[model samples]
Target chain A: MLKVRVIPTLLWKNFGLVKGVGFDSWRRVGPVLPTIKVYNSREVDELILVDITASIEGHIPDHESVSDFSHECFVPLTVGGGIFNLSQITSLLRAGADKVSLNSALFENPGLVNDAAGQFGVQCVIVSIDAHRTERGSYTCFSHSGTRNTNREPLAWAKEMEDRGAGEILLTSVEHDGTMNGYDLELIERVASRVNIPVIASGGAGNYQDMIDAVTKAGAAAVAAASIFHFTEMTPLGAKDAMHEAGIPIRRRFEM
Target chain B: MKVALINYGMGNLGSVRRALEDLGANVIIAEHPLMLLDANRLVLPGVGSFGAGMERLRNGGWIEALYQQVIEHHKPILGICLGMQMLSGLSEENGLHEGLNFIPGKVLRLDKLGCSLRIPHVGWNEVNYREGMGLFNKIPQAMDFYFVHSYAVVVEDPADVSATTSYGTTVTSAISRHNIFGTQFHPEKSSKSGKQILKNFLDYTPC
Candidate 1:
């Protein structure tokens, strides 16, 4: 049976990891490698390492840095931020990244998904949509670390990404991010209901109940959070216990 | 024991190496098929389209070398994900493509299951493997492994199937034919249970 994954998102900044509020006011959390080691040992289903500034800086993911980080990371590592072409994806994979998450690059060149999935197989391409709830309550995608508005709707954009052969969708609520209030359950349900692909709900996971709500209420296949782990007393394993108790099919933890 | 991990310009070779190294196994990234001669076991780990994986393997002179190493010499080899699918008789991914034909089957798209479930069944799923088999001797029944694949091999022989997993349907998750073995899930990224699997593979001695 398919199990719900509890993924921990590591927002990468210049060198270390950071968590931002409303996609701004960044604060360094810790280094990259050690954090990955901590998560991997905790039996986290996957780790998403996004260099929040890569797209804004007009740069690609640091292959060498990712190589160093992935060596310590045993779980599936999805590296994002500033990826523009297939060559960069290839480099990230060669650096030990299991999947590459594309955002800003998709706004201009959605064909990259088709081509990347065509070559690397659909399982490797992840289209991360950062949705900022506008004043009208309609979700609009924000690109380049939520700085630029792509003017694309999350529902239609997620469907397009799925049509283009994305293996999974990482839907993040820019406003709800770092708030630890709760995942934008409605935003997640909107896209999850539209596409057949698995949707990983991100942002506003303050407690165990929040992760459970994302899966049970929002229909998210997986739940990802950063601040919940950084600020509170929540751990991935503890969240899994909560989700498992809530009747979600969670992966059985194994001993070495 | 040295294990030659075939790198035909497709697949995540680095992740596999780190995973194996964590298990205390010597892993060599084999770009050419010649490296298989020195290793005790062989690992064909890949991620890409069926046609492209075969094209790269053939162009890199891996097809003939792999055949000699696994079929002729009977070297224990394990294929992971796309590598496992390549063991099939054929694949109907984007086109009707030929595979290594090591195991009897064809790789077909999972979307044909006609279920509302997601395609490219990503994330962790349980694998129910046959007991007493060397490949899964250390793995418990219904243990979850990290899986991310759209195509699954339709095995010709039911006895060839070593493990099955539940998705929208009962799908073949692992196959074993004598000394040959393959898994649709990635063991390297599957954490503890996955590491135990790698260890079992290294110690497997098909009598």
Candidate 2:
């Protein structure tokens, strides 16, 4: 049986780790490398590092940092933020990133998804959707780190991304992000049920139960958290233990 | 012992190389087939479509040399992920494409198996292996390993299957027949359990 992935998503801004509530008022948590090292020790299933400033600033992701993280950590590393072109994707892969996530560039040049998937395979291309709950109660997709509204329905865009060669979808709830309340289970279920690809639910994880709810209720293949893992004293192992008790299939850390 | 990590322009070679280095094996990224001559063992690591990967092996002039090393020299070779799929006779991905044919099997899409499971079968999953398998020595049965792929090898002979994993249906995850071995999962990225498998590969004696 495939275990549910418990991922620790690290937000990168100007070469440091930061945590924000609802994608605003960012606070520096610590240096990027140290936080990664700590997670590496805990044996987190996977790690996602998103450069919050990349798309807005029109700069590429820090390949050097990705290389460093890959060298320091033995697990899979996914680098996102400001990945707009095939060359940048190529460089990141060469620099040791297992997968690259795309957002704003995906809308501007939707063909990049197909191009990257063709060049690097679909498994390596991830389309990250940041959705904000609208007044109509339907989720609207946002890009540029939740700063700009794409005005595209999250469900429709998700289906299109899959058709465009996305192997997985990283769905983030802008309304639930950094709130530490819980994931948007309804949003996750709505998106996951419609698509066959794995959906990784990100944002609003206040406790282990929230993680469980995402997988059990929303049909998420994996659950990603930033604030709960970064701001709290809980470790990935701890979260796994709780999830295991809740009957979630998860890989246990081998006793050395 | 020296191990040649084949770089055919697919998959992440960094983690695989680092894992081997951590296990104390003298690892070299063999870009050319000639570089693999001096090595005692070979690790074919890849991630991509079946057609493209085989095309690379042919274009990079690795197919002929690989056969020479594995068949004539009997040098132990372990194929990871797509590299493992390449060891089979053929693959149905992006239409039919020939494989290395070192292992008697064909690659088929997981979705076609009629299981309601997700395609690609990504994430960590348990691998059940038979006792005394060289690559699984000291590794616990049903130990979890990281896997990410849409297709899996369907071995012709059941004896060749050393390990099996289930997603929607039982799929061949690892195979070992004499000097040839292949794993559908990425042991390099599987953390501790993965490291143990790599160590076992390093300690494997090709009879």
Candidate 3:
């Protein structure tokens, strides 16, 4: 049986690791290597490395940087940011990422989602949907690092992602960005119910209990947070232990 | 050292490069013929049509050079995804395409399982090992590895199948012969299982 994942999403800038805020204003965190080393020590289930700057730069992930990151990291790594084509996707995978996350590319060329999943594998293709609350009080999907709004309902986009061959949906709440209030449980439940593939809830996580709530009450297959882990509010291990205590079946350190 | 990610102009190459470099191996995007000569190890990674990949290799002059280096020079070479498919003699993908002939077999496309199972079976798949093969090195048994492919190699000899995975039916997941080894699954992108498999291949002693 697949266990719920407690993933720590890392943002990459140039060759260094940075944290993103509302999809902009990247603050240098440290190098991705040391961050991943700590995550590995904590025995995190998996790591999500998103190149928050890729779409802006108009290039695929910096291979030289990712290549450097992979050398030090010991666990499964999922990379996103600027994955535009099958070649770029191939480059990211071959560079040592377990999966490649796509957002703006999917919205720009929906066929890319299916074509990439067809050539690679659905498991290797992660459709990352960044959503922001609309004035209409419905969640609207945003791409290009949440700058461009698709005006499509979040759940509707999620179902489309699945139908288009996305193995999993990394759903991030733009409204919840940097808040750490807890995941958008309502949004998670909405998307989780709509898509068959596992939904990794991203954004607005406050603490370990937040993870439990996201996974249990909200029915998220995985819970991803940035501020808590990025700022060291809670270590990856402590969070995992907390999740375990909360009765979420997590990947044990020994198992890793 | 320069590593060759055989560009038949299709298949996953980036993840393989990332994994190899993550393991501290110097990698090169091998396309032209001369790229294979300078590399300490050769990594032939693939993803799409078997025939197209083979044609790309042959037309690009990598097939001949790779054959000489692996078969004649006995250098360590790893074939991944469609790269693994090219190790066999032939493939049913995109009609019949001649493989590297390092291993005896024909690659066959998996029949779509009824009930929306989907062709090109994608996602985390478990490889059931028949016996201890070093391709898994330090990895534990029956772990889930990432997979994405519609065609798999049908080994002419049963002994060539190193590992198997079940979808609608049992499919060959990994195959090996002498210094030559092939994996239908993308071990580069399989996470820990993938890392362990690559480590195994990198550290594997010739039989």
lDDT per prediction? 0.89, 0.90, 0.78
**Candidate 3 CAPRI assessment class:** incorrect
Over B10-116, each residue of candidate 3 has an lDDT whose tens digit, in order, gives 64465577677776778788767777787777888866678888888888888779888999988778888888888989887766679889889888878822213
Which residue runs of candidate 2 sit more than 4 Å off their true CA positions?
Answer: A134-138, B111-116
Ten-residue stretch with the least lDDT total in model 2 chain A: A247-256
lDDT of 1 by residue, B59-83 (tens): 9999999999999999999999999
Interface RMSD of 1: 1.5
**Candidates by TM-score, descending order:** 1, 2, 3
Residue lDDT tens for model 2, B52-153: 999999999999999999988899999999999999999999899999999888999998765567676778999999888988887778888888888999
Residue B77 of model 3 has an lDDT of 83
In candidate 1, which residue ranges exceed 4 Å CA deviation?
Answer: B94-98, B111-116
As for TM-score, the candidate ahead, 2 or 3, is 2
TM-score of each: 0.93, 0.92, 0.76
Docking class of 1: medium
Candidate 3 lDDT by residue in tens digits, A1-256? 3467778999777778777667667778888788887876566667899887789789878887777676555556889988888999877776767689989887779999999878776878889989998777788888888888887788888898899899889999997877778888999999998888889999988888888999998899888888888776687778878887888766544332
Question: How big is the positional error of residue A22 in model 1, measured in Å on the Cα after superposition?
Answer: 1.6
Best by DockQ: 1
- Isolated chain A: TM-score per model? 0.99, 0.98, 0.95
